[model samples]
Target: MFINNTWYVAAWDREVGADGLFSRTIIGVPVLMYRDSEGRLVALEDRCCHRGAPLSVGRREGDCVRCMYHGLKFDPSGACVEAPAQGRIPPQARVRTFPVMERHRWIWIWMGDPERADPGLIPDTQWLDHPDWRSQDGYIHYDVNYLLIADNLLDFSHLPFVHPSTLGGSEDYASISPKVDRLPDGVRITRWTLNTEAPAFAKKVREWAGPVDRWNIYNFTLPGILLMDSGMAPAGAGAQDGKRDGAIEFRGCQALTPETATSTHYFFAHPHNFSIDQPEVTASIHQSVVAAFDEDRDIITAQQRSLSLAPDFKMVPLSIDAALSQFRWVVARRVEQEQQQAAASATGARPAQTAA
Candidate 1:
């Protein structure tokens, strides 16, 4: 089950034009997104109150959307202002408007009660707009459950096998164990591979004279958001001892938004702090990331296809699955808490059991 009382990334900031409307199905709800005349981001249910037509196909008339099917106009608040050929508008002629916020080049929408949507809950992704870093927006659609992608992010062991050439450079990555800490909302994973061969992407940005010390430190938060600090330095440079004097650093921000039960919207960007002047470095880094993600997509898609054949099959876990397992528990616990709260609101009772 999906958690409803949370914010989900709906689209990139550049996806919606000044005078255009963007539509997408988020968590089984079709949503229409656009900017009002005042440049405010607005999100509404794509379905119309009358005749059930999609408002995405309608025309914009000065901050209002006019349904082309029968000329029903709706304001940014989702209220029907004008209904042609009808004397008075019906009381139930308003569509649902969701709370939307545009920050860090990502458009986020509240999928639950509007009153509970706090802007402070959104994660920080300032690296996308920081002057010291250089990066471009990247997106990819996955034909698997968002949780599956989340599992991939929490477990770095797949890097050696799934992305050996692109992201993981040596088999030693699979042998090395990472430190995992469970957080209130998610989990934090820190891994360091000292005196190992540098990954292919790191070699592309700058020439590495020999084997280097690599590190992947990241936080995988609730609702599938990953903020990471990953990089490489020359071997025996005291990188493992927290010395970053001659290291190349990269910041990765990625979001996984569910489009359906078995589909996901992936938004990502990897910004570098070492080469802000050379645009080619940024371009090359983006290209390498795309290639590596393509590898992930292929394997995950196959895994989904196999799982679909046996819906009730239970799998075994290993030591490497600690982070992913804990993350799944966090998601499940949050979903259950939301369900309990909703039931309590309906029946006028307090929830008793708390997830551990």
Candidate 2:
């Protein structure tokens, strides 16, 4: 159920260090990543073309990686350049290389055709490294499908029940329905809760005299990327009207990469524009967000277990399911379109070979 042609978050920039080889299973394919001698990022199929040994366990020789199993060395392009024991390297002795790029403190990899990997299509997440905003990188691994996490993100009504003490503040979040708008690649959801008590985490970061007005506006894009602008201000501060005076602003960035059929790699960070100079404030916010996510993970994993037991059971829809349903449709359509295109290409290639 994965979109093969889409770009996915391979890893945080810090995960693959200058001299370290990192490997992870993305969409069930093992990927080996590292920086070349010139410091350029490289992503290649982890399996060595010879004997099927993983290249991650091999040794790095300057800009190239050498498979220690049979003494075959490959360049950054995944082309076999040397075979120590053979007179010549076969033309087909090469591993597949994926299109990879580094931006916004994350490494992005295109899992399909290299020719279709356009850097411009990558989403903008400047808050991740912008000077005005401050945040720390956070990553979590889940033993559940990535789409399940996406479902959790699209609907906020569960916050009051799932994240009661942390992200959830009051029942108003569950009672008040949000506005869901369709986007070209995904969906946009906006919700406002007025004159409500701040969540426990918010109170730890800033002092609130009484009730406040808060807004959560975010865009969940294809391949599971969420960039959000959520914040709070005093009850009469006019935040809902677009005035930011005396407002505590935060930017939420989250990326979900499918590890396998029932597992996911979650990368996230919530940056705050207000406390740019205070590292403590950033740490507190990060800790709270992690705690809240732990709560989400506990319930989502339990639900996944139950789903496995009842594979034929269908979930009933509710008003809160609007955004998630739309987002799932967008995903399904893209995946179907990709499958159709692949089938067409295969059909066209067969005819060209027959004519030749």
Candidate 3:
């Protein structure tokens, strides 16, 4: 579940164009996002107050979005600016507006109380701005609870078996042990082994970039944002010679927004060295990664279904799953805290539980 009072990835930068309207769900709340004439971002409840028509179906007019059912127009702040039929705005006719911001090639939306909206609350990513790194962007839809994806990402032990043909089937998997440090902002930074049997790509890195020692790092920010290192060695340098040494590096960010208790929308950003200077090479890398993602989608969806069908499913986890277990507890605690806060607000009482 997404933490309350946090910014979640709503859409890619290029997805929202002039006069474009996109509707998405965050934490089970439907939101409508659009761009104004001046290229400013705005978000509001997808539901129109009038007869419950979806405002996302409305047409864009200047800085306002007009309801298709009636000609009612709403400003960026969701204030009812014009009512074509009444000629005067009704006091209670306004729709709720949400605070939004654009950063790091993504549009972020506030899903909790509007008063808690703070641009600084958004996760920080200094790596994205580094000139030495290149980035690619994409999205994925998961047919499982978002929390599971978060767990999967926090642990890399599954890589050896789940992604054998991809980046995992290497000598590094044998001695894999993650070093995790929790940050003051509730984020976790983890660095783990990355080369086992040193894959073809690692070999390439040794050849072109000199002696290679592979390690993967992940910075997981609260409410489902992960920044991971995606650089790998080239072929023939770390492993046997002339063995199709091309490897794809995947440093990127992922945001898992809950569509419901059972589904999630995954926004991913992958940056690699091979495609840093070439647009064509970048596009090819994106396609290849997308195919791998499709493989993951199939596996995760099946796991979700099977888990849902089980009555008392339980699996004993090894040390490698520690990060995953810790992440799950963090998510569970955050969700519980939000629920307690909401209950307390309803009764005007002190919160029953506080953050640890």
lDDT (Cα, tens digit) per residue for candidate 3, span 34-123: 888788888899888877788888888888888998778888888888887686678899888888888877788888888889898887
Residues 123-242 of candidate 1 have per-residue lDDT tens digits of 999999899999999999998999999999998888879888788789898888999998898999999998899888888888888999999999999899999999989999988888
Q: Provide TM-scores for the models.
A: 0.98, 0.97, 0.85
Output the TM-score of candidate 2.
Answer: 0.97
Candidate 3 off by > 4 Å = 126-131, 171-175, 184-189, 192-195, 198-212, 230-250, 273-275, 353-355
Every candidate's lDDT: 0.92, 0.92, 0.72
By TM-score, the best candidate is: 1
What TM-score does candidate 1 reach?
0.98
Q: Evaluated with lDDT, which candidate comes out highest? A: 2
For each of the candidates, the C-alpha root-mean-square deviation to the true structure, in angstroms, is 1.0, 3.7, 4.6
Clashes of each: 0, 0, 16
Off by over 4 Å in 2: 349-356
Weakest ten-residue segment in model 3 by summed lDDT: 235-244
Quote the positional error of residue 160 for candidate 3 in Å: 2.4
Encode model 2's per-residue lDDT on 138-249: one tens digit a residue: 9999999999999999998899899889999998878889999999889999999999989999999999999999899999999999999999999988999999898899
